[model samples]
Target: MNNHFKTAMDQVKAEEALILRTSSYLKNVENKNVRRNHFLQKGNQIMKKYAVAAALAVALIGGGSGVYGYYKIPVNYLSVDVNPSIELGVSMSGDVVEVEGINEDGNTVLEGVDVIGTTVEEAVQTIVESATENNFIEEDGSSVVSITTETDSDSVSEELTNAAEEGVTQALENENVEAEVIKSKIALDRRDQARELGISPGKLNLIQKLQKLDSTVTVDQYKDAKVKEIMKAIKDKKKEVKADLKEEVKEEIDQTIEEGKTEIDQTIEEGKAEIKQNVEQKKSEIKQQVEQKKSEIKQKIEQKKAEVKEKVQQIKAKNKNNGTQTTVESTTESNSQ
Candidate 1:
């Protein structure tokens, strides 16, 4: 009986040890399953985050690409061609230059003028006359004005000589004819002497000199022979002097004409260049303006996309937190049950 009781106690002890071992194994298996499930949940969360990031990146890249393309496209295209039918006429004389354009329509006339006269009075007079005839001058006479006058080489020379002769003759007639004849003859002889000395006579200077002569010569008769000699000398000298001066003036005018032609050509070329530059500048400015507008639009689109992405991230975070809290509450309720 004693041996049997000992054996029974040993058997009970073995059974209890087996039960403990089984329980430990089962607990280990359960822990391992929980660990695996946790790992899977974490992996799924990471994958979701990556997906969101990829979408945002794609959106941003697309927006940037779209903006680039928009700007790349040409916004303003300008085409320029010279119109052969459109005639631009330029007329120049002395310091006056006039430019006029004839368009397709007969009534259409575009004109511009620039004058640089030796004297301010001449410039102002020419501008006023041209403006008045062309109706460019306003009623108030305070408008931008330009005028041009053309005179041929030969015509200008003739006119100058005639003006000088008339001026000289008029001064001689103004003095007393009989009494001052002697002094006049002396003056004429002096003018001839000047010519022989290679001194060129100036009309204005001669007139001034004659006006300064003594008034006593106007009533004197004793100097008649001397006066006759002076008059004859003066007449002969004037004819020769006028002829030489005309030749010299003609040569100068011819040279001036050649220079004027060259200047006019240069002016036309410069005007065309300026027009081309302005057109190019306008085209570039328009293109830049369009590009700027496109850039603005692109930025706005990108900002909107970013805002949307931010909102989506916020919603995802809220859902994740709520799910975690609900799971924790369920676990607590199960333990309580």
Candidate 2:
């Protein structure tokens, strides 16, 4: 019984130790699971906050209502062309988003200028002022400043064109720069074409139209040419064409008058010839008729003369016969006597 009790106590102690170990292991596992759950909950909260932030960011960017959308979106492209051609990319709010020089002189004109974030008018004025300082624009009223607006929407283009014109005019007046301000609008495709040719759309368009009038007018020749120069060339070409046309018309009129005079002289000569021929023919006809009548009158007179002579001869013959017979009788009577 002592051995069996010892064995039973040993078995009970071993089982208790095993049960304690199992209980400790189970507590450790539960603690680990609780910590994992807590960490997962914190991570989920963090993920939710990040998701909300990301959604808000997407909404802001996608809706284009935020500051990033306001200043970055280009709504218009205004090109200021003189000797120095500068183009301003404007935002929807009229703020300038970019300033690009279309040519070498334009780049030189824009050398230290930072016009981004300014209004369209302010940018235009600044560029004009810079150009004036650089001598690209003359003080005399000989320079022509062409402002062309490029946009997809006509309304936006017109508005920006007017705004740019006003700005340039103001800048010129402020700088005491007397210049002719020309305002125009162009499509975006034309702007792209202009950029490809390294010229402003206004200049390119002018060159194109001038090309139509004069085929010798080339973009390469006039791409860097001043607006006033191009205008002068166009004006001179038109005058030349007008003068040529006038001369052509005058020549045509002179030729027509000469031709008409020649035709009239020929017609008069023909009429004179026809009149002479008709008068000769009528005279010949009258002469022939008079000769025929005179011939008939002479024949009748001959016939009358022949008849009278015959009558006279007959009377004489009769008288002679009678006288002969009377003489014979008388002679016979005389011989008898």
- lDDT (10s digit) by residue, model 2, range 93-207: 5668888888898999899998998877788988998899999888677999988888666666766776687788888888887998877778778988988887888788778
Stretches > 4 Å off in candidate 2:
1-67, 111-119, 307-337
Report, for every candidate in turn, its global Cα lDDT versus the true structure. 0.39, 0.80
Off by over 4 Å in 1: 1-237, 254-265, 268-272, 275-279, 282-286, 289-293, 313-337
Q: Candidate 1 clashing pairs?
A: 182-227, 185-230, 185-231
* Model 1 quality (TM-score): 0.22
Lowest-scoring 10 consecutive residues by lDDT in candidate 1? 76-85
After best superposition, candidate 2 residue 269: deviation in angstroms? 2.7
- What's the distance in Å from true for residue 76, model 1? 99
Model 1: per-residue Cα lDDT over 131-244, one tens digit each: 334443334423321111111223332332232233223323332121121111112234344334332122112323333342233211211222223344345556656778
- Tell me, by lDDT, which candidate is best: 2
Per-residue lDDT value at 5 in model 1: 81
TM-scores for the candidates: 0.22, 0.67
